[model samples]
Target: MSTSETTTMTAPNPAAARIPKKTVKDFKFIKEIGSGSYSTVFLAIESGTNRELAIKAVSKELVTRTKKISQVFREKDILALLTDCSYAVKLYCTFQDERTLYFGLTYCPNGDLLQYITDAGHLEEEVVRFYAAEIIEALEQLHNRHIVHRDLKPENILLTDDMHIQLTDFGSGVIMDNNDSPPQSNGTKNVDEEKKPIKRTNSFVGTAQFVAPEILKRGAIHVGSDLWSLGCIIYQMTTGKHLFRGHHEYDIYNAVARVSYKLPDDFPPLITDLVQNLVRLEPSERLGSEETGGMEKLKSHAFFSQFSYDTKWGNLLNQRSPLETKVKLSSRPKLSNDELETMSSGFDDRVEARLIGLRMASDAPNGIDAIVTGSSNISLSNETSSLHETDNQSTLSDQSSTKSMYNSPSSNSSFNNNAPVIARRLQMPDHALSLSEQASKNVYHKFVQNNLIIKQGILDKKKGLFAKRRMFLITEGPAIFYVDPDAMELKGTISWTADLRIEQKDMKTFLIHVPGRTYYLTDPDQDANTWCKSLISIHYRYYNTDPNRKLSTTTSYSSSSSSSAMQTIVPVTEL
Candidate 1:
């Protein structure tokens, strides 16, 4: 029997006909695990079987607003089709209500592959080979059914408890049949068409760095496109960086189109050869392309010579993963009823704060009095008066240093104690720019010029009673600044001195400690490790480059210290 026929005979169907009538009430939601543009995934317990499942709740209103109704249905259809595949996320059932649609999928307690990669910096070559082989098996199953997963990235590859891979997110996928003709060659196009420029798609889909050259060129997407993404993922697995990266999408597209990239000097020759063969500019020339020798050609490569699919494929799930020793799956904490309710509605306050430009404790000049109250109200008059008091107390040397730090000609003088404070109403920029653009222009130009911005992203800063969103920029000056992205105003800066330290409280929460104060911060993307690593790297870079910098006499705290040691350390009241 064919692979498809065997899969059909063995796997149980999870269609609407087989599933019983169910509703959202059938499951008890524990907490939200992940979210996307249109859907939020909640970790829930099935009441009947007491099984943990990840319930992807799609907002019907968002679907209608974004005109993605068809896309939602397509994902459901695709998930149902993949019920037989061990490497794909299994969908048990689907249900909907007045406001939301829910899909109950097998929950992977261990997080996505991105989190693992980020934590480890990069995987060992042996580990990379194991994961790559499983990914190839998954892709073979998809391609056998004529399904093309256009969006393939580490974030979409979830890890199970046993460290096995389960591919998810089929929203961007499409099915191709034998009747579909191959993409036309550049030379075959009409003369008039050749002269016209290639316009970008109205809504660009898929992650920019992993997208294939053919897809960027507006050519027909075939199975070869997936191999390109696989190559990119493998490269990143070996090196803690993207194969093709840029400050903007256009730059990444240009590099991909020209196949412009250099492997790291330390890259192993075997892995490098495998990646080069897979990411060829011409899809047909890729190692696994049908025109070439197909997947067997890739399987026979020296890099994967140790992994014999014929002997190992059936027992792959039983084998222990190499990452099993390195990564430990943490147990999820049980939440109280009040905590659950609070979390369900907690995001609304953030949205309102962003809309009205509510200043947090960190944003104010004095920082203490400007604390956002429980009601989310700020007393601007008191803050302004405090700013005036600070200006009167500033020394001549302090004033000069402040001026030199943030002397922008376009805006009112940068917020310093020596200047009269102006309450500028926050407004959107004239042209819309991505988050990276805003960071480059506002953070780089206004604060650290010439110094490299190591990392910048939105992080929630926990103040006295509430958490407020802020754009954080980490620079090579070994300095960290939290800014109001809307107003492009600098709020406060944290210098990464020798005494500064970081503590990871949990997956999302982390604490930064200076001499007297501790800053409680949380990453919405659950990348606390990345933030801590970047800050530590900057600190090392700064001290190593400048030999004359004196070390402080204050007691230094290590990140590996027990969390119990932080019990007495209070969150910073002032910036």
Candidate 2:
């Protein structure tokens, strides 16, 4: 272990699950190892085995706790399956004791690659070659199993006790089977209709520091994404600087696509050549040149001419680094103390505001009520309070959709009374339908669960006080949904617009009458008040008065399409 750095393994409180009385609970409990959004890890000792290991205990209701529930399952399932693989963490066992799920695994006493980088400003060319070789070899093993460890960054690449590299987290890894859909490991449906040529996902769920250009560009990707990420790590090691550390997605993509970065003037030509190719915006033309060509070609490169894999890198890092990366980068984006404090304050305000709104919208009149009064005549009352509460808790706890909703300023809204009301209102532009949530969850009170559908031409805007509404056509993986977009406008007036389709039906659409209050109504019997909390009670912009531009342009909708300007929420895990 690195200078008194202790390690241990743990399981859920055995007593909670009636652990056998003689299981021998004598292992010493150490401090926490890692704390992430869904889990916390601790290092503990195994009294029986007299060995140390890392124990990860996750919430049993990880589904409710995590928005992307499949990801949690993916992590546990992949880790447990790959315990036999030398390049991956060795999972000891998986067990549950009531409210928590546990994983006992071998501990990495050397910490992660990030710790190594933190101790060294920049790796020597020879050192970089060694780590790079190990990482690619590890990735190859994972690919052989048809797994793509999508979230690859320094933090996830840990060094085992003997200094060999081990890939730790597989939360984002998707088992893309070219054959029939890999039997849905978790609760994730086959999305059979969504089956197509395995390609890169434009919508990302990984850290920006190591994301590929294809992901940034809203383009298709495959195993090649892994190579691109590896290139970023290579650059970080050599330069001791982040490759694409930008705030916005555009800046990140631009850097990856255009190589808008500066490197040391003496950077070896062979090293530069490899970096460029690995960071190539196109996957087919990425590094290694051929399937088995990665390590072979990399070995032959002139940059590694001084290296010998035999005894060359056995314990070079154990010898220690000269300086840390944070010290080497003088040009790193520096935030002043005052600036950090101000930014923190702003973030807290936004979070508080959002929490208040979410609590309200989810309260009295939210999804449950939306169904009862609108399309479905199902009633939610005393007899179904228990079911309603449980469903409400599930929706609030689900991490996928609402995280983006809370983070986004443009999408979330509240009503404002002082705002100028639209005086001469015409039909709302058909394009206003863009604001609706693309992933529609229809909570049928009678069914008392979530209905997953991509609703199309959903009733959006009510043409009048009581009229057929403007609806948006939304698509996800392989389904389509119709969403109604009736938002409040100037004071209490409903900005009325009619899609030619809704105009034909002429059905009376519903609207909340308060001037600037966006309340989630409970689907109660006609007697009770349903509004929970107020997310935003505001009128959507009526329309930009421009006759030259066509309103609601005929944009083709496809579930497979990746142009997600409107919210297509996906929860990103550290793994």
Candidate 3:
């Protein structure tokens, strides 16, 4: 039997039905690997099977508040439906608690395609073809079941440990009734349906950059909608950038509506043809659409000429991946500082402040008093500062009395009074701090010397193709410092100037343009707007404060046949 026929005949995995009996206690959670608006995915081990699984824990309260209960259940149903599909994530079982619902799925340790592509820069055409074929096959199975994946992007495509592709995240998928006709090899459809210009839908779905033009125009989603997204993913894989990009969602929508884009100068013509064909403005005209030749037409494209669907494609999972040498299994999983802080509730903030104060005192130019009375505009906390001040004062007083007793001729009479303080000091022995603690001291001093911290938090810093988790500290000097949170090491610093510009890329992402480089950062808490506004405000404050600053300008003269001349100079400022 053909692959599609075989997949269609396969029975749903019986394990999906055995739900609700199990509980969270049945599994041992390792650590959280990813999180979304309402769900968090953890690397866990199922006690019953003793196998590694990705357990997705969904917040019941958040889902209800957002009215996404239907989407949650729909995803569960879709995952169950796809249980037997090898190209898709397998659902082992599901269970729930009072506060959260959970899904036990096959763990793909290689991470998602977006991260993979990012780490690898741009994949070779051959590598892209290998992964694309697997995605196409997965889509074939979904379409055969009369399901359209409304949201298909690189983030939704995960890589198995062995590097095979597994299409996941079916929350936006729509399942048509059995009465609806599936896409056929030959171009054929109902006469009345074919006559319509476009199908309409009131609700919008999918990522802004990857959504098809028809979707942006309020057109209903179909199998063709996914093909357009696949094309965008292919472009990103080949070029390492989005095909349609903008600073805002509406800008991206405008670009998609106009079909405005330019390919890289070195882009291969054959790949260009395939991408253009797949992203055609009319959904019905797109390659692989039911009105076209469906999956057969897409497979026949020159870009995937090396693989034969009948034999070679079926065994892709067994073959060695092109990225075999590049892909390395992590020896150990280190929890990020964000994750650590979330898991460690017993971590005392006051204790941390005291530790930091001790370290600061050791490095301060004027001893403990310098740190206690430093000219810092930023305060860690009101309670922390007060506690630190009181502790420092008490220690200093004890030391002063001890010194007086030792140096004075009336020392014998004061001995009893100073003995307890000396004994207390002796009891608190001095020892070397750990590397992380020492590094924290250095970081703290570095911030203090630069006018102290204004705002500090964990954010993802985009470096080349990888997004690294960094502890970022913004200082009163209008400087930005990103540090390795785990190691407490300073990575880089960006000092603000009149030429500096801060741009908000989206709700969570922003860009900092310096003189020579632009830093891309993403906040997990969706606080990019606040970050941008604060940075701009600080920049203006500094600019206005500088009395020695000059209004640097350039002269531009109008060239006209008439002897009249016009000079224009635009003043540069923070945006």
Candidate 4:
């Protein structure tokens, strides 16, 4: 999954006095359990409480100077309202002192649902149903309060030692309505009569692989978006894959807009029906809440024929007792002496120069009007659109600066303050780029298909089409991991993926597909012309002697990286 963009929650200082620095040594920093773009979560013994808690340590200064403080607050707000489930990770309390915001909460010893599924390859029907039922119940609670958990995917759902689920991370959730009034946009103001309007909304918000179709298209949507995402997750759980895994972000959004699901022959009947209904193109056509068949109504469908929400899961809504609130941290995300200096020297000359150039230019080819040349909103003309569709993307590319500023309505002060991540204009990183690169690198290294190559010691059966992931143990090629491929209209298998991690070197990992009964020479590059010929000869000497056999591996190796690589040839060992 792409790391959800984090918003800094640092309170602004009246004067730009230097922020104080902190050493992790202050709190009994326990095991470094996990990390994301803006924070690190540790399994620690909170001095406040004698119990083990998960401390989500985010650099308040990092997110704020970068400008996502309001987004951080939104996460806190969403977590606070959802003190409803045993399956949802309980957020004990959120408080801040200076450098870090400490969230005192329960630690799931079992990690997340991905580990369980990766360990088992796919989920059993009962398990998938039970979990889905739990999620549906949770969705009902969230929707009742007018909150939308925009990002719903497997990794965000945690698993306890007993294997029950606990959903965490509300960073991407949006409160659709506040105080019975229409919710305000996040710092987005009404378009000026003089200025051109921006296109669709974009965010480092939701993880793309599991994002709902409606969310991607920026269409009229509500909590049902979560159900569509739920359908994606459910399909992955039962079939070991996503229902409509796309090759790119635009592709993912495109598929979501259509709401079409392609099921494989091996998929279960009940699962097929359930996912299809959940992923219906029109939000009202899908299951749960206000659709033609409401969630309570859906509980009675044949796919859920064996289930009875009233007799079974309905009891969850009636529970009243709260888990004893034990630990609350007044600790805020802090900066270190050196980090403060690095942050203060935070201006990106490259980004500044680029923005300056854009500001000075007068000509924008007529159709690219919706987007501010280099923003996440792609330019799509209502008509006369490009025949050959391509993703012309750009990014905000500064250290921690936000240059675009517009005023909000006088009383509309409720939106988050997340700073846009700086990205390069022409060469920004694509979504799910990690999957393509990893597929190219790992598959290329192994002369043949070898699961052992990926597993040396890190083998897992739980990670699925949408969730299984591991770090690079060797600093070799692009980090690679497997996600199950889904059936698509075009042809063959299609799949989705999480992001590639590069900050750490020991994280290098990869994948390959070798035909059985045929010993073949490895194609460092997945080139078609040369690879097609390589498929015919069994002798390595043939490859060594012929200059015609050479081809680039750049394309075929990584969907994102290898334009030079070739796909594995169809089996014809008899030749």
List TM-scores for all candidates, in order.
0.60, 0.47, 0.57, 0.51
Better candidate by lDDT, 3 or 4: 3
lDDT string for model 1 (1-575, tens) is 33432333344434534544568767766555666656767777766476788988787776665555656665766677778888899889788877778898989989888888877889988789889888898898887766678789888899998899999998877545322353233212333432321211223457778888877876755678899999999998998689996543455778999999999898999999999999999988888878778888888888987764543754667787888887777776656556544433212345325322422333323443322111112111111100111111110111222222223232342222122111111122322232244445443445543333446676767653234456776643345767654445666776455456555545566667555565778776465655654453334333322211222434555553322223212223233
Which model scores highest in lDDT? 1
| TM-score order of candidates, top first | 1, 3, 4, 2
**Which predicted model would earn the best TM-score?**
1
Give one digit per residue, the lDDT tens place, for model 4 in 205-225: 575557766567665546677
In model 1, where do residues sit more than 4 Å from their true spots?
Answer: 1-20, 178-202, 308-311, 332-575
Task: Tell me the tens digit of each residue's lDDT in model 3 across 1-575.
Answer: 33332333243434346544567767656555665656767776655455788888777776665445656665766777776788889878788877778898878888778876766778988778877777888888887776677789888888886788888888777554334565444322344443322111124667777888766766545678889888898998898788996533445778999988888878988889989998888878888887787788888898888664443756777777776666775564555546534342211344335433543354333565433222222211111100011211111111223223323353333122222211211111221222223245435545323333444566777542225666776544445666665455666666455445565544556667544455767776444655665564444434422211222223122334111201001112211
What does the lDDT read for residue 182 in candidate 2? 37
RMSD to the true structure for each prediction, in A, is 14.4, 20.2, 22.1, 21.6
- What number of clashing residue pairs does each candidate have, in the order they appear? 0, 57, 0, 59
Error of 2 at 374 (Å): 58
Task: Say which prediction, candidate 1 or candidate 4, comes out ahead on lDDT.
Answer: 1
| Weakest 10 consecutive residues of candidate 1 by summed lDDT | 382-391
Model 2 per-residue lDDT tens digits across residues 378-419: 222221110011211211111233233334454223312122
User: What is the TM-score (0 to 1) of candidate 1?
Assistant: 0.60
